[model samples]
Target: MEGGLRRMSHHPRKRVEKAVGALNLAHLQGAFYLLFLGCGMAFILMVWESFMDVF
Candidate 1:
């Protein structure tokens, strides 16, 4: 009975680790996406400003 309890505990610990790893990956991906979006918007604004200056 004691050995069975130990085996059951190990499975849940592994599942927790897997869940934490997946969450970390999702956070990193979201951060990178925001960074790229900000950079693209800045580039577009610069182009627009330069065109306006010429006119």
Candidate 2:
């Protein structure tokens, strides 16, 4: 994960290398999507916990 992030150098245009373009595009999006879902669930859990504590 760290290696992949280092490869990007935070540049949009250079994010994908031609040889592994398909692999990178597919998996990177999946990784980001799963990360998004994970964060969403964590936030929901926190909100629910606080709401339950109120009662």
Candidate 3:
């Protein structure tokens, strides 16, 4: 009975730990995507500025 109770308590902690790890991974991926998007926008603006200068 005592072992069963202990296992039950530990299970939730393990689940919470897994959830935290997944969240961190998702945060990292989001940051990576934002960085790429910002860089792409900067490149497009630079191109447009140069094209405008030609006219």
Each prediction's whole-model lDDT (CA): 0.99, 0.87, 0.99
TM-scores for all predictions: 0.83, 0.63, 0.78
Ten residues in sequence with the least summed lDDT for candidate 3: 3-12
Q: Where is model 1 more than 4 Å wrong at Cα?
A: 1-3
Ranking according to lDDT, highest score first? 3, 1, 2
Which pairs clash (backbone N, Cα, C closer than 3 Å) in model 2?
none
Worst 10 residues of 1 by lDDT: 4-13
Q: Which stretches of candidate 2 lie over 4 Å from their true place?
A: 1-19
Q: Which of the two candidates, 1 or 3, achieves a greater TM-score against the reference? A: 1
lDDT of 1 by residue, 1-55 (tens): 9999999999999999999999999999999999999999999999999999999
Off by over 4 Å in 3: none
Q: How far is 47's C-alpha from truth in model 1 (Å)?
A: 1.0
Model 3 clash pairs are none
Q: For model 1, which pairs clash?
A: none
